[model samples]
Target: MSKCIQGLSLGVLCLVLVSTISGALSHEGSVALSHEGVGRKQNVTYDGRSLIIDGRRELFFSGSIHYPRSTPDMWPDLIAKAKEGGINVISTYVFWNAHEPVEGKFNFKGRYNLVKFIKLIQKQGLYVILRIGPFIEAEWNHGGFPYWLREKPGIIFRTDNQPFKYYMKRYAKMIVNMMNKNELFAPQGGPIILTQIENEYNNVQQVFKERGADYVQWAGNMALKLNTGVPWIMCKQKDAPGAVINTCNGRNCGDTFTGPNSPNKPSLWTENWTAQYRVLGDPPSQRPAEDLAFAVARWFSKHGTLVNYYMYHGGTNFGRTTSSFVTTRYYDEAPLDEYGLVREPKWGHLRDLHRALKLSRKALLWGTHSNYSLGHQLEARVYQNSEKNVCSAFLANNNTREAATIYFQNVPYYLPPRSISILPDCKTVVFNTKKVNAQHNARTFHHVKDFSKGMRWKMFKDSIPNTEDTPVQNSLLLEHYNATKDTTDFLWYTTNIDVGSNDLPLLNSIKPILQVASWGHAVHGFVNDLYVGSSHGDHVQSPFSLNKPITLKPGKNKISLLSMTTGFPNSGGYMEHKIAGVSKVLIQGLMTGTQDLINNIWGHQVGLLGEKLEVYNPRSSKKVKWVDAKGHDHEPLIWYKQ
Candidate 1:
């Protein structure tokens, strides 16, 4: 029998179910987490069912918390809050670009100190998952690979090429040696229970044909050679070789993803995307707390053993680390916001889910799993543990629009539409995915005292290139990347087109259509100091195009086309070949004929004058005038900083 203790709005309620099962847990549904500190070795293994930690079959609730995403000062609060939120495993990607921005040069200081980050998690008694992807495409720039790597001679990324393999081996070995010296592996009792290599490479391997399969095998072998003494995983890699476990990554991996490829490996969901990352100019996304809980329950119901939320904290994308069109704020509607603040309901609801799952972990890990159809669109997934004389069960309702009532173990239980109820003892209805008992908290932002009294700001205008300055002249407009070398986002292509008084209509037309094609992501056109037009496109989408009718004087007319980039793509087929700047220029819609301007004598400028003058640095020694910018045009081509 069930009793309703309190009622809430919107059909929410609190329940207490009377227990009748004689078989209960040994410790009465309490979780004991005791792994912490360093200098202790552990024997970690896995089976088709779950991970065996020190000979004990275990299930984990994991979350991703990128260390470089935030500073060291914020690590404590973020990690402590995560521990308090019931996350036992803290996963992170060791960004290669952040560690080794240049070839043969390395850095591991401040936020990039991976050792310090792992130690902090150990201090909190949580396990760590080191995803040393070298090519992590978590909306990270260049997919976390160093820009210098792209310049290597005859090197193909993520393939079986010798140049690529040599460098990959060196980097991977360096990381392994570092971890080994520090004794960070679980066998060394340092909280790092598992490590991953070569992220999501399987997504693009099919294009490589047989070479792709060979590369996969080689990568797996190389990673396994490191001997981290813990199981290695490859997310989204279906053809993962040997003992390396292939995991799943997606929004909902329960119904869509099958079990792991190998029967001896347990089902692992490495990246359960809480919500999609926000793109620039797009509104924030929200994944309903109820739906997230339902997905979690569904995964566990389908015999999933270890689950990791892609981003539990989803911190801010500091500096220029964001990839492509993604925003600097990568909060992604996670349980923890960009500033490490706890999001209501998501944080609390997931915490409750973790606790309830831990309660039944013993049964789920060790007991035999089976499914039975209870009724229409309803099923019961039961875990029977005859060894301990205790069992657990999940009552799931697959119906989308209606609640379900099903009889299980001679008891009639109510399941809400598309939800699951957990019975830790097969009798007591302990928790339900649809029932959120935690306090629904709402927060308010309040400004501090003396908000804007002493605020002083200076701005600088990024001026266009004048005719007096000698630009880098080239017979052919250089490719954007080769010209700028990734130093700046702006590239200017300036040219002077002569129009005679007695010329044809195509050359002297008053309002001719000046067209430019494929300028990376965005472009701005100017004809003789007047802004003609601008155009933009997503970098991953089609090439950009700018077509504007221009009023050119019947003489030497200066045309300046400024090309802009969002950020380099971190993931895609042949992303290295992506380029910016206009390849073809044309002036059409004339009575005579069209005029092609590709062969014109073009002058190129890598960046803006504001960039050259160091205007962003307030204390620079250069004597540059600062404009208040209070009444100036606030459109593009202006630099503002505080």
Candidate 2:
């Protein structure tokens, strides 16, 4: 009862658990192997049971490594590390926004070079799973859709709408053609064995309502037409069409998930999340290495043939590519850290589990399965090759608090609470999820510099234009993206307000305040070029108001507002419609409607004037020279350069 309640329902969990045990032990299959040489045409197919590579059943271990996440120089080392970690396949999402930031224009060089990354994987004797999601939501900008797509009139994205489908088809075809021309498809004897059409669309498909199904079907059909000669998969899309295979994407998926559509399709876990992506102001999320290893072992025990870690090496986000509110460090606490360092115990422990799984491959892939209830929350699952009397087994203890002992096949074995022990012969334990054999290494930070010697520094002030000098727009406010095209993080909103004697008397009486309402990641206010106050919004889309006191100048007074963005919203419904910058401004306590600056002709500047002068560029020919400085330490509004 306790086991059943802990699993939320004993019958369902037991039924699935029993089925997994039976599937692993009962395999009435043995297929002849076909050989192939390097650079030779190979075949990859899957029956309802398992993946057949060159006419023989095979198991695959894959890991995700986004090319754009890491520099080009890091690719070879990263791939090599993955290979050494017992990974036989490398998966990557071809980022649409990174490759084509502008419509009708594409870039495939440097870090965005998909071909180069694939080739490197192939050189390491690994297969590839190409996820070409024009709508990939890997916490990417605009969900990997180019921002220019928002400019298209009446263009509803990720749907069956004519405009969206047309553009989606064009881009998909472009990628397919490029790969085909380079002979990079599996049918062309390349490393790519599988291609993913769409990402986890089912999660947000409800927003599209009736069009969701149509869009999914369309995406599947489009991928099939590409003729890649490899299977197409749709992760997290349960109602996926017949042509595409739907796979699971989270941890412990093997415990509850089976192939969608048909049992004939092999069970595949596309993304076994090792750790979670970090957001700003949130603690780093981590998964125990022991738990991760247990998940993998249980997956294989349930007859899962292919399992891919979402991130085997979660690299750095670098630059402004991170999603809004996400921290600059893209560390997902994967097997490898952001700097390519192996995450101890997790890396070594998983390596050992992989080795143990390989030892039982023959029995697992071709034997008969049986499961027995050892009672006391302990279970024994066995896989036996009747002809050769060869057997493998998994003994599990599900109780959360107390460990249990079980006698399987008349052999007494101690089982740790909430753990699994693997026995290749069904009688001796070779590996146990609870017993860790890897070394643990703690990280420490060392101080590399002394600040006791007060160092010399130089300062430069940003040369910003006043309302009289900058270009003025008739509109009172404008969206930051539309005005700046995301070329810079800063947007200047400057306007002049006249303070007559009548307004001065009111301003002096109530201590008049300048009020501004805006949508932003952050905003700064200036009155007569004097810094007043600043405000910030949440990581997601949010509206904030700023209020600052101002001194009346009697005649004309200038107000400058600086609106800045951390990054744009990368996911959500109608995110393209989100706006930034000051929407309205007013001086309260100044005699009502007379002080409204809503319709004023505001001066607009895309970035600081110092940016134009190349003051930040160390190698610029027009770069400003630093001079010996004194006094003015810790002064605000001063820009320091090395």
Candidate 3:
């Protein structure tokens, strides 16, 4: 290895190691890695230690990068950066909604092109790990489920329901066949080596009892039937079938994870959460680089031969792909930030750590390992070949507050608190968990104004409910998710409130409060076409209400409420069953104490007229009468563009 692999944390194009496909070491129950897949066909088999490609065990450093989160032009740079960062394998989840937004309609163009993304990785002498979780809960909309899937007449999600299974199996087979047709699997001489079926089902399986467990078994079997000629895996799932490999997922799985359920499988850490995802209205969740290095070392020391960073680079969510409270900025504080820039000391520190792991390749795969302690709370893991010579060594200090000097092989070694020191030759300290040799490279974006294009504004007011559109009228208010199937965000709820002459006499002194109780993400209230108030919702109290003072005519007054949704629920077992829209409409502080308008004839308009006409774009702005918003600035329901 040269200076290029030393401190260069995700440098653009200096991956000297890309030219070779050499054997690297696996942990205790050993295996070793070979070259990337291409040209000639190869077999992928796994022993009790790690994945075997071309009859060799692989010590993998996998990086996650979802293709749909980025554009085609951005793939080469992102993949190259991952390769430069010492990642031999690329991991990604197949988002169902992005590919099949409408029933019988599929899209694989532009950003949703999975085939192009995988090929780009193969072109760089790297392997691919396709996690085809049609129900992936990546904080993605509807948890990567197709919009039409939730609309099926008799359907229950993630259970032993025939309707759900029918669709899930259909989609999974479709993906596998697509990969097979493209010859992407390793057995077909392509880059893909491993494929994953169900994502973290164990977390929510208890909610459904026996049905969830049955579904888990069925899912594993269904994936095995695909026969991609590679092994299948299920993460966060316990009691997995014999054909599937059960892997660990968490920030630290070294101490808690007890390998795979079966003896024939290896210890694999699928998701090493680099850092938690940043949520809306909150600061970026962070995990220190040193601590991350410590965790990786611990996992390897504990016999985990394969490990993957949940997000080596968490790209942009873009558009309305975000779910729950997760921000559109999907930067997970990872090695590569949202913009694909190397995240300073973090990227550099991990790169050096990978280099050290690669250097210990042969010893870790074939040598006998002996575990011993240097002192109290200090331990050493040493691997030796047939000659009994120490080839790979690791010194770890488990203390969080106290530093220690441990003597290994009769030589003194200093370790920082909560750190790991790697000595590949048992004498030279190549890398330390606490050391950061990479320089910090912060990204700066410049917003320059084009003075030539003068500021001219195009404005339009959004249409109110029931003016020109048809609505679904019912005696009871309908759940927005069920009513619209998430076809639109703006759901118009219109109803009439009648106040008799006798009730006005007592209402002369007290003004009635218009309280619109909502179950939606947001609600905008209007009394007789006049905008009153609006209340937004978070992951917190979702049944939020909007109480505003109202002056209504004594007769029939139409109340129009616009219920909006940012995105649907992404987690939980029965998350698809959540209801959205107005639940109750009440007129309080009246002479009669309170009047219930809940059972009245309520009309629902699925979407807005402006949205239907595409008036937001310059080409379609001419279709509608755009109001000059020169004076009415900062007002609600007004669309403005420059």
* Top candidate by lDDT: 3
lDDT of 1 by residue, 1-642 (tens): 443221112222223333444645333332224653344677779988888778777778898999988889999899989988888889999888889887888999998999999988888778888998767899987788777776788888888788888988899889988998988998987888888989988788987788889999999988998879999989999988899999989878898787789889989999988887987777778787888899998898788978898799888787778887888888658998888888878899999888778778767877777776666677777776666665788888888899867666555788889889988887678778888887776667787756345655556767777544537876687788767766777888888888765443544436679989965778899888678889888734668688899876667888888987766778975655656677888887655468788888888888888878877666661468776756655555777655
**Residue 473 deviation, candidate 1, in Å?**
2.6
Off by over 4 Å in 1: 1-39, 442-457, 466-471, 502-510, 589-592, 621-623, 628-631
In terms of TM-score, how similar is model 2 to the real structure?
0.89
Q: Cα deviation in Å at residue 460, candidate 3? A: 0.4
Give the Cα lDDT of each candidate. Answer: 0.80, 0.76, 0.80
Error of 3 at 53 (Å): 1.1
**Candidate 3 local lDDT, 1-642, one digit each (tens):** 211211112222221111111232222222212343244577999988678888776689999998988878989998889888888889999988889899889999999999989888888778888999878899898899877887787899999999999999999999999998999998898888889988899899999999998999899998898869999999988778877999999989998786799988988889999888876677777888898899998888777778899899899988778886678778658999988888978888888888888777666666667676666677777665745343667888898999888766545688899888987665578888988787877677786987335666767888676623445787888888888786777788888878776665364656778898888888998988888889877877678889988777778888889998888889888766877888999888766568888888888888887888887677987778876667776777888766
Displacement of residue 530 (Cα, Å) in model 3 is 2.3
Which segments of model 2 are wrong by more than 4 Å? Answer: 1-38, 256-258, 387-389, 447-454, 501-510, 589-596, 613-616, 625-639
State residue 404's C-alpha deviation in candidate 1, in Å: 1.1
Better of 1 and 2 by TM-score: 1
Candidate 3: stretches off by over 4 Å: 1-37, 387-390, 450-454, 467-469, 500-510
Write down the TM-score of every candidate.
0.91, 0.89, 0.91
Total clashes for model 2: 7
lDDT for predicted candidate 1 compared with the true structure? 0.80
| lDDT tens readout by residue for model 2, 1-642 | 112212112222322111112333334232211124434566888887677776777778888998998888999999888877778889998888788887778899988999999888777777889999877777776678777877788888777788888888888888888888878766576888889987888887888888988999999988889868888899989888876888899988868675567776788899998988887777988889888888888888887888999789878776667777777667558987887778888878887777677666776777677776667677766676766556778888877778776655434678777888987766567789888898987666687865435666676776546776777566568788778765677899998887776766453545678888888677888888788888887764478888887676677888888988776777666666767878889897665343778888888888877677767677762467555456766544567754
